[model samples]
Target: MAALHELPSQMRAVYLREYNKPYELVTVDVPNIRENELLVEVHAAGFCHSDLQVIHGQFGTKLPIIPSHEPAGVIVQIGSKCSGPWKVGDRVGVLNFKNACAKCVGCSLSQKRYRNLDPRFCDNRETAGFQHDGAFAQYLAADPATTVLLPSSLSFEQAAPLMCAGATVWGALEKATSGLEPGATVAIVGIGGLGHLGVQFAKALGFTTIALDSRQAGRDLATEVPGGLGPDLVLDSTASDAAEKVLAFTKGEGVAAAVVCTDSIVANTWTLRLLRVGGVMVPLGLPPDRWQFDADVLVFRELVIRGSYVSSAESTRRMMEAVGRSGVRSHITTVELDDVPGIVDMYQEKNFRGRLVVKMRD
Candidate 1:
């Protein structure tokens, strides 16, 4: 089409190719958009640990796919069937879900907690970076329904992680800290990307937050990084009496709620133990293996352990607005798309800190 011809015939992109192998950079045709899709010129894509999993064959994603779901870009073309308030030249961010059928049970129920749990949605869902070709490229076609408008004050680099990191933690925090009055105690059990953002959100929401990490380095990150103003209390997760310390910090009643963002089973369990009776624990991380949770504490204390999946489209929109209003942002180290392979290696060795975002175009 003449509209498509106005754009480049081919664009640079990275391909997964083989499992546990270096991603290959190659030129590929600009994606053609469906009637309900928007062709976005990606400016930046956030490098998430989930992308690392796709590289390591851990997630078993369809191979030879482009990975990196947290992308922010400008719309270059709009499809005929695409509706809503979006238009060309609009800045937008793509969420984890490519599309969700409105007729699904999840949509009908309209329960935010079950946003990603409904089989009707989950069974047919296409997850960017996990199920669909993601944003590790120059251009991508995204469903307008799943994309949200970016705040004018936010740069692409900052807005990119909101697509996943920000949205996921926001959903978890809303669930974990619901009905928590100001000055209420809340714990974030992981000072990495997700935990760090959780701290910012908790603080912004007026909670007396505690930062927890297994290592000194992560604790320092929680305190030093921008948007990671050290919480009221910092706890050593590896300490033998870590849970006891949390209990003591909250006047022996334990935290009103905690959001566990670590994939470590022990960390998840520790946070669960750190909750007060009837307290809420929202687990957002994907652990490597199935864990046998403590049923004794569950039944005795009547504690609630809720599982949080990626996030609903509505959560993503609200997160962007909150981030813009609250001035909460991630500490991102920008790299070019060409450095994606090296970034993957850095992730594998756990060498990088904060979050990495690829500047797809200058």
Candidate 2:
């Protein structure tokens, strides 16, 4: 790998110069790679809703920042003090969270209890495209610890969405089905970017997967899963008695769990009714606000309700392995770097479906 100092001083990047405005293509200084960091030549970056949130100031982001989180690339340069087996020319997937202070209490617990909890201990923590420059650029500097080495067979475009969307659903599924036996039944609510991937992951884990979406279009797209491992049933939530339809599909036993991937409180509230006794409902998507439910439902059903954030590097690796074993493909539409602004507009209008990948490398 080339040394970091040997790289050029500036590179092309997409920046959100102002909130609620379009991202502009501009040349910015190549990030100064830390001793333990690698300068990656970004190949592909996935367009996530969170990026739009940051762009619109929904997340109170600092302006003049790059707006992207799901990035995959090749190591073009390694910092001087960097160590480990990784070398230049290695393809890698980037994690959103940057560096975690190893000495903090949370970091200790994260390392001892669960490495995925490391974000809690992240002191110099900078989420890509938010506090720091993200992968909507030609080059990105990332710590080796947070970057996962991708297999040679995995393309950068394929690995991009897995970094975020795949990890989010994978983590939620892991939490939802921790004690679940093989062949358990699971339902995924809202078959969008996260839900579509969630369906495949659930089925890969040996669950009877059911997908629920608002539109017949989404249902049609989800029903075409590879090898007929598609959803056992696809239902439109717009239809009357949607919850009853789910119950009917489950033979009246209800699903062992339902993953809510929509940021709709109504959807989350109703999805709880679809869970059987002792069933879990894990929310990965952000709702408008704290959800309110009837106390009777919670007490009578003894349902397990929880929220899952992005997964850690370990869980991400597990997700990647699952995708590798299952040969799952991301149904992505490729757009050039210049199209980011227009795509962001489409996203704000909620007009696109499936996952969108920005091809930074042309």
Candidate 2 lDDT score at position 197: 87
- In candidate 1, what residue range of length 10 has the lowest lDDT sum? 114-123
Model 2, runs deviating above 4 Å: 1-6, 115-117, 120-124, 348-351
- Which tens-of-lDDT digit does each residue in 108-134 have in candidate 1? 564455543332254466777777788
Q: TM-score for all predictions?
A: 0.92, 0.93
- Residue-level lDDT tens digits of model 2 in 67-111: 788999989898777766888888899888877767677677777
Clashes of 1: 0
For candidate 2, which ten residues in a row score worst on lDDT?
115-124
Give stretches of model 1 more than 4 Å off.
1-5, 101-122, 227-229
